[model samples]
Target: MSVELTPGLILILGALPVPLLWGRVRSIYLLALPVLAFALMLDTPNGVFGQLELFGLQLTTARVDGLSRFFGYAFVVAALLGAIYALHLKDTVQHVAGLVYAGSALGAVFAGDLLTLFLFWELISLASVFLIWASRTPQAYRAGMRYLVVQIGSGLLLLLGLLLHFHETGSLAFGHIGLESPGGVLIFFAFGIKCAFPLLHNWLQDAYPEGTVTGTVLLSAFTTKVAVYALARGYAGTELLVPIGAVMTAFPIFYAVIENDLRRVLAYSLNNQLGFMVVGIGIGTELAMNGAVAHAFADIVFKALLFMAMGAVLFRVGTVKGSELGGLYKSMPWTTGFCIVGAASISAFPLFSGFVTKSMVMSAAMEQDRFWVWIVLLFASAGVFHHAGIKIPYFAFFGHDSGKRCREAPLNMLIAMGLAAALCIGIGSLPEFFYALLPFQSEYHPYSPDHVTAQVQLLFWSALAFAILMRTGIYPPELLSTNLDFDWFYRRLGRSAAGAVGRFAARIWQAFAGAAAAQTSRIVEKLGSHYGSGGIPARMTQTSSMVFWTTVLLAAYLLLSYF
Candidate 1:
């Protein structure tokens, strides 16, 4: 197959000339690229294409299976939505980077082998860093560098694992890569890193909030979703993911609660939501996998919607810090409504996107008789409602008035948010359309009496708890202070350790130089005393003495040469 015909390649190659175009034409082109790519993807028949022989091994460049097609659709829609969101921007650099990053993610989703996946995987890091750097702030620059390093590290681990897997199994086909070998373990960690697993997740929170408003929306959409898809494709049914997913879902709630930056809160929320998909994938059943994919698809829209709302706030108000924002609904009513929609969706409100999808994972856990996992997930569900569902909109739009007013978000941004908000409600109210796109056929329903009652009760109680905490002054106030997270090991503690090591090394070098200087001085004084004008050699004025010295020197030279 021609490489240009590939769905991802279209967006990538199409983005190169965006700078040459101007104004409305550029916007149309930018939006059309993703739509065109999506059309091509839809037209491409299922099964493998773009086969090639490399080093006597066959490589499949494109695999349009049910799984890949589902993720591909999600990526394309995200790209289109992101393009619409960013249409108000004039920065061609961000434009190019966003498109290429989206295309790279699509490429990875369609990749048929580990080698092919690695190519697009590294490209994703390379292209996406530009989104962070497009912010052109000192913070964004540093954050982008860190994000690049972590992403590249993931690629390196994937490369190493694939090499080992190829050696052990003589194949690099990306299938159920269980952790039964060293290679499989490495690959699992690679996917985990991209998935923002536990301690490895600070990059998302650190770099995402620092991106350009539009850039962050794109960032929120692609990278982690690709990781979730990869895990679903390769590591589903792995028992360990159950516990790992539980931790992923549960731990972020604490940090998000105290986080002053609303965007960072969403970043943490993104991690929490990923945990649900991870749990579904871990179950490895048809219904479970369906739940995972359904949730992933739903999440991309609502998460992007949340990011877009925050981005609009940042674009107009100059900051998204919870301490610095309040009563925004008075000015940005559209943005406020969209943000609330996103919050409700993420919180699993009865008529929202998360309600339909997140329950699938929880139901899957319950069906498997995983009592502890179910409990943890339930706790996480309530916790997310407290932080993301209630806290985000409450603080940004209705909390203590910051006495700041701003114009509404741009029309383009509002349209993008409206589209995303509609998708969230649509998926929730009419889940059949969404569920039909899943990889597997499942009869699981999302609107059961017990399910609705339990979810509503959970949300109601969680909201009530937040209300009491606020009224009683028990909730952590959003203050202008740095909240320490796992990144402290590198950002603070790690920097301090590095400084200490550097200072110690400098002292050691100083001592060694001092000792060497003293030894050299002593040797110099001795040589000066012996070879000075008043020394023995200077006193040896007689010809016989000189000849005797010359003969001795000649003899020594001859003896050393002979040896």
Candidate 2:
């Protein structure tokens, strides 16, 4: 309780000695950082601390309130889970990067000023990229680079917007910054990029699957959630986000349904889930805000569980492609069961985490008369069940037998997944305790007859539809082929277009150079004809001609001077 340091610093600083410590000492040290941070987070009271003034501007580095407190708890818990999940690895880079990344996210959450937020915001990207690169594959390398560019670009946009906002308003406070000014709009897009806004979301799917197995789990828990927290803090009630979030929710279902890579499917699913939170933030009502925050917390748990499950498959069988995986339950029964739990949670099954949290946003939309938004969310919910709820578990664990036999996930991974599954069930089964931690007070019930009945029916019909599609051979088959998304515009199409233009430009340059070279050669030849060893100037009369010309020039100068 007497600890003066914020929890974020504790984790970040504690990671310093990780590389030097080895064996059980290192593992203990790694696990203790998160535990200590969590304890410090819980002990810290609600208030602002670590205020400073620089260049005549006030800054609050640590702001503890309901919103920050909620995110902080989730982030710290994620770090602890990640640490446990990664405990068996000898990869110190991952451990350090994961800790620092989680700490940076917490730093961003607690930041009370835009400047402080920006500082932590950029650090998150720098630290998390190592997770992707840790895979040590060329594909992972390229993905990490692209992911870094987008993430750092987001930070730069945030920085530029905050600076402009400071100049216009003479304040850097992190509060409602609706899209009324250029600065606010820039800031909005910056948050949108991180939130996986429609056209700006390719990075999430592109990079997350490329990370090391445990790395992907850590990556899933931080960046977007912090972006969500930032949006809730600064851009809440911005109506434009409603439609944007709706688009986010709807489109990824199409991609996820056909995505061959199971991890990539989850990545798309992550984008879909974020849409619910984004919609809640956009609604800006107390209930909507509560829904957004609550869903984020639940999502961190369930999503991680799902990713951990797939990660385990990737670990044991060396692949997560649905086309190549089946009958895995016999080998990894615990993992299979956990993956199903995750699927149910994400699909919003009654009495699951997603059901309890996601419904709040839908209810808020309905209350706000956002008829279309509510409808799209409903469709998205079903679509998620179709792909994520059934597809992930079915193909990976129960579909056509791939005859791939392997050991279950490591003890650490099983422990981590079990804890996450427990949290999902716990939060869903006992809503009051989790609801109490929400930013706003609410009496909303997630288990009322209407809510329960509708959710169950939606899930049931979604599952039935999936069965019919599979039975009738109408479902999209998972194939080991690339599925293009918005990134194709830049990654393939844009690159090709640029290459064409570059070639055209290069051809024009070559033509010009050739013509210039030809002309220069002609000029040089002509000069050689006149002035070379065999030319007139080289002949015996050259000295006389030169002297005559000099005499004529002298005579003309003398005549002009006399005149």
Candidate 3:
């Protein structure tokens, strides 16, 4: 097939130098790059752009199918918002890294083949790490290292799985996979790790809160969303994902409720949202897939909006812990209001983005006769409101009157948040615009009486329970302690276990080396006895030569008698 370069790729490549030369150009390049990329993405056709041969594999880098187009569109919007949110930062390193990170993610989603996806997957990892490191604190450095390790590790698994898959299937195309094959399972887990599936989810909570305020906004948009896209692409309809998604939905609320760090709470909330998409993927019908796609697009907007709000808090207050924050509405009313919209949207409140998109996933579950899954999802949706919707804004802005009189977020930050907030309401109010972007036709209506009434009942009751609990002093207050998560396995258990084994092996090696040395000394002494000048063998050889003549005659006589 003939290769044609899309405007998206061209704009992304052109953006590479903006950060490096940012100082010379006074950061105009930093601001312009994302806008240009967004425009380019909007211009690209919704079809495959180019195909090429690399390493004997057919690699297609820009395939703009329906599913990919949805994600790519979201990513470009995310890049634009994130750039605006991060406009206050003067650091060129972060500016460049963020642009590259966004571009690579768009590239990955649009990739037609596994090879191109894997390449961009690794590129996203490489470019995104700088955001964390830009914080320039010891904690940020440590967290960034861990984040890079996990991300790179995930990429390696993806690469391995892709290679094995290509070898077995004789195709490098990215598409649906079954658990029956090792390659498929490998790819699933690889995506799962990024998806923050159940126990593999701690890296996000650990790393995201540790990044710069601007970094957190960018961080929120890319990694897990990309993972969701991959799962939707390769593992949709895999039955195992149903329960995984269910657990993902239910478990994070407990942590988010009690967590001190606001960004970390959002991280857990992110996991919960991903669970909804995972379930939609497992259902695998056109409506369910559309729901997943629609939810993902909506999620990118609202979730980024939420992060942008919290990032603004962190940016101005110099901290984002719920414990350290309170009563910010007095000073930053606009920020607070924007945050409430985000919280409401995430809570699936009526006439918000979450209300429109998340209902599709739940409806899809019910349609598939997944009664129990639907119930669990219902509980999760309520829990989402309890934690993300109520808890984030309540603690950050209203719980206690924190005496902080800080200024509102920078103009760029406000513009970014306002843009995201607008999109959140826009998508929610006009569901058709989002529905049209879905990969499949949407036969399910979100505005039906049954859906609306059920959702209202669930959300209102959840809210009532939260209020009663809080009023009666039953709800847990946010504390300044780190909650144990999946990272504990690597951070505590894995590290301790590896250290113990290492020490044990070192001791055994030391003893073995000492014993070998002693034995070698004995062997050298025995050799010396036979070969040294003072030894019996040396003297015997010298003396034997003089007696050789006499001994030869006696030996000859004895031999003659014997004959």
Candidate 4:
């Protein structure tokens, strides 16, 4: 295969002509970009391309390798699924945004240098927020703004970290940035923020639920997964991520159980899923990294399947709130079944996508003798069954009938959901295929007796617990209200502090302005007195001030040039 050009550019440049095409041409253009990009990614040989010296530092814009090829497949698959899902929409802006967002992610995955990574880092952040804005509601607008701030803030950290790294190491390479220096630490948190690390995760919950239905499904696929890739690429073997990932896997389940918004619940679920991958990356073994990459791939498919199902409900019934939804199985039975499949896959039921992938991470943890972390992961596994596996389907489909009836999801949405569901089952049932695609060879068999029995027992126990809790009326009821997460620290407290700073700055500015006005008045009076008809050369001085400053600037420039 010829490596003629950078593959990420296919989507990036292909998106430029989107809005110009009319009717079916635009649709074909949108759908073809992902396919072309995926083909290019598959065809490109393993080597660095687009190397250049910028300011005496080498930059590699395209680095095609095994790891990058894996993520490239993920990005293009996501975009293709998203494109098929969005085929009916006439919104070229949204299509353009999706393409640019996907392309930027691809670019980042293949980036061989820190500066190149940062370039696509900012672009992905900028391009993705439009998915939120496409919702076109005041809430979506505000949430999109907040999402952008957090995302761009991550990009800023990356830029500063890269600059400091260049200064410290005199290299721009983007690999193995261990957290032994200030720059590396900044870069870690930068990836951490995008990866939805515990304190930095509220953006996912706050904004994903607020995005357009299709937009949310697409949103589910990128960003955080990219962060996971970045972590695996640069921070592997960094021991701190082990505990961090453990905390991530465990905490979000509690929030998921309580979250009334189904999509927000999924958002929490996403954070939990990321924790498993992060743990694998931190372990930094071949099997563990394979687990992380494999889980990421399966996760994108099944998670997006779940989101697409809920998005169907959102599109048809105008709500995905647990309080407002029930007995959807009667109307949207296909969506109900798809949602169940996704729920099962995410819950790691035997023969589901997650079952094949998630176990590798936990096994890797056990291999590293991370006994407590493995215990936490075990507990998290059960908790996911309770919240995501059971609660999601039970509340949304089988709870008390909410008396809301609507048409099924549109045809395009169904096809998209079906395709994603098929992939989830295909990957789960045929683990050998995906295992071969992993960055390392693995002999981890998920269907071994101990593995299947343990998973089945875990599911049974978790289901029993949920049943008892519900029967005893101890379970929390879904209500029409928002739950606060870590974002409160900033959204409430930070906003107040910012308001205070703005007021203080305004007062200072007003004082300075008044004083300046007074000083100007006196100066004008003095000048008027001097520049009166009998005064000496004051009028000429006013006219000559501009010329004088220009000549002074010229003289300074000449002196610097001479020096």
Candidate 5:
């Protein structure tokens, strides 16, 4: 069959000009583009097309398959919601950046070869950093710089790994890779960094909170989800990711609990959510892969919704810090309700999106007899409910009623939140719609009585624990201080180390200059003493004594020769 241009591709490419030419238009086009893209993606065929050759390397620009379709659908939905959330902002830079970032992620998922994936990967990094920078604050600028550095670093590693893999395998196809090879390991770390694996997670927290309200919405959707897609494509079933993902799921809770910045807390929560997908990839079975893809789909929805709610607060209240916000429900009841829906979904409450999706991954873990893995995942689930599902809304809307009476979010923001909240409910009520899009056949049921009862018992008990802890003053309250993460190494210790080295070098240079000056002074003083006008050597050397001595030596030499 002849290659055909997909509607999704057309919409994505066509939307590029909306921000460029119409700077004054409201975000209507932004909201419409993703919906159009989704409409087009639903009709596209599942196969490779639009092939081209670059420098003798075969590149497939459009390759639609089950896995790619899953992620592509999520991207379109996320972009739509993000555009709705950001409608109040007039900065065309962020709007354009958000579109390009979304397009690139979609393009990356559908790419048929490693070279194509790498190209779109770098495009995402380059395009998305502008979102953070659009905040127009010094902290945002610095955070954007760090974000760019880490993203570019990931791109470089990915490029190097692709080249090495091409050399080893003589092909550039995107497929499963084993960690036994050096190239595979390089590729793994590239995905790991974007996946926010442990120490590499600093960029998410550093940059997300610093972004403009609209920018953070876009920031939360595409970057890490794309990384998750890449991992699902390249490193499925790699045993190492199991433990790495466990740590990713477990450790972010402590930080999120104590974090004062609501957006940063969400960023930590985002890291924790990625762990579920990572575990699915590690399980490497058909059902597990299905769970991963489904969770990723659900994650993009609810996470964007949460960010939307938080972004709306930032738009109205001028801050998203937990300590600075409270009692918003009175004035912004619509926003408060939407936020609760998002929180319910994230907490995996029954009849919510996360309930339908996250349970698949947990079920997959249990199926594999991963006892410890299941236990860790259970604790992480509770942690998710504790930090993101409860604490975020609790502090921002209901806690302390800080007497701040801000207006509700813009019309577009509420519409976006409403749309997302509806989807969260829709997906939960009918998971078949989501299950049908999975990479593998779906045999899992999320609503069994035993499963529902068990989850409720676990999560409700966790909530009770949280309530008791708070009532007795055992639970830590959000403070007005920054919680340190991996970025501390570079932001704090790294800069301090550089400063100390600079100061030490300065002191060494001063010492060397002083010694050189002393030596020069001694040489000059000795020369002046010996060669001054009144000095004996100065007076005699230029006089006849030198001429007499030369004449005597010459006469003696002549006499001796003659003898």
Candidate 6:
């Protein structure tokens, strides 16, 4: 490849001329850009590119390696699929934002230096929020703003970390930044915020569901995974991720169970899925890292598949609320089929994409004798299958009919769903295909007898419990209510706290102003008596007052001499 050519930059630059094109030419150009990027990525040899000196420091703009290549492939694939899904629209801004967002993420993943990574990282945050704002609703606009603040805050943390890191290490290379120093800790949390680590996670759940139907597909694909890649690259085997990952896997499943919005349910499920990858990265073995990368790969395809199916429903019926949607299968059978495939894939059902990948993390946990953590992961798995697999489909496609009929998804949407569905099956049926793209080599098999049997039993019992609860009418019915998450603190208390702070500040300013005004009024009153037209200074301008003052001064001087 030419020295001037960067796989990600090509896509970023390719977006520049999109507004100038018209009709078929533009659509073709949009579709070809990602494909062209994929070609460029494939052509990138395993070496550095665009190395330069900046402020007397070596900056690597491009670093093509096994890990970067895998993520690059995933990012472009998602971009291609998302572009095709969005092809029916004539909105240039969404199209351009999608390309730029994907390109920026790709660039960050391949960055060899912290500076290069930070630049792309900030660009990605700016670019992706446009996808959220593309919905053009007050809610979407608000969510996009919230999303931008959190994302930009994360970028700021990264900048601070990088500056301190450069000072401490005298190098800006982005590699093996364990949380042993102040700077590394800052960088870790920066990545952690993006990775949706527990309480810091509300931004993903908030912003993604508000995205435009097509935009959510793009939103779902890149941001968190790039953070995951960063973790895998920097903080592997840090030990802290063990409990963090366990909690991530466990807590979100409960929130998912009660979520009213199907898209939000998927958001929680997305959190649950990341837990497995985090665990694998914590394990930090060859097999474990492979598991993390492999699971991330499958997660993107399946999650995009789920998001696409939900996006299709949103496009057709105008809402993805579980309470509003039911019996969609009768109107949109193909989309229903695609949604189920994604549901199964995410649930880690036998012969699904998730089965081959998630188990590696759990298995790695067991190998390290983390038996209790393994147990928690097991329960989380069962919980995931229940909510994401059963609830999403049962509510959206097969529940009580809501007496609504709509046309099938548009052809382009259908094609995109079909493509993602195909990937879901392809990776599940042949795990080796996805496994080949992992960062490390391992001999873990996902289909052993014990593994299959244990998974089956866990799923069976979970399904049985779900049925019993439903039969007894004890399961929580879908309600038109927003359940509070960590965002509640911000949306409610944080806003209140902010208001209180503002009010207190205002009162302090008012009190200060009042005292100053009172003092000034006192001064003005004294000055007015002394210097007003009828007062002494005003009268002293006359000849009689001047002579009286001069005579008084001479008398006082003569009295002092006599004394």
Query: Which should have the higher TM-score, number 2 or number 5?
Result: 2
Per-residue lDDT tens digits for candidate 5, residues 1-563, read 14354334554575567656654354556667787778767777788877788888887777888888888888888888888777776787877788888888888888889888888889899988998899889998999999999999999999999899999998888888778778888988998999999999999999999988887887888899989999998888988888888888999988998999999999999999999999988888888888888888888889888998998898888889898888899989999999999998988998999998888888888988999999999999999999998899999999788899988888989998999999999999898877877788759888999989988998889889988998899987777897777788999999999999999999999999999999999998888888776665567755576886788899999999998
Local lDDT at 240 for model 6: 94
Runs off by more than 4 Å, candidate 2: 1-5, 508-563
| Preferred candidate (TM-score higher): 1 or 5 | 1
lDDT winner between candidates 1 and 4: 1
In candidate 4, list every pair of residues with a backbone clash: none
Question: What is candidate 4's local distance difference test score?
Answer: 0.90
TM-score, per-candidate, Cα-based:
0.92, 0.91, 0.90, 0.91, 0.89, 0.94
**What are the runs in model 3 whose C-alpha is more than 4 Å off?**
1-3, 6-12, 23-27, 519-563
Tens digit per residue, CA lDDT, model 3, 256-348: 888999999999999899999999998888878888878888888898999989988988899898888999988788899899999989999
**Candidates' RMSD to native:** 3.7, 4.2, 5.3, 6.4, 6.1, 4.4
- Candidate lDDT scores, in order, read 0.92, 0.92, 0.84, 0.90, 0.86, 0.91
Clashes of 2: 0
Error of 3 at 156 (Å): 2.0
TM-score-best of 1 and 6: 6
lDDT, candidate 6, 127-190, per-residue tens: 9999999999999999999999999999999999989998999999999999889999999999
The segments of candidate 6 whose C-alpha lies over 4 angstroms from its true place after superposition are 523-563
lDDT of 4 at 256: 91
- Residue 75 alpha-carbon offset, candidate 1, angstroms: 0.6
Superpose all Cα atoms of candidate 2 onto the true structure and report the RMSD in Å to 1 decimal.
4.2
**How many residue pairs clash in all the candidates, one count each?**
0, 0, 0, 0, 0, 0
Q: Ten residues in a row with the worst lDDT in model 5?
A: 1-10
Candidate 4, TM-score vs. the true structure? 0.91
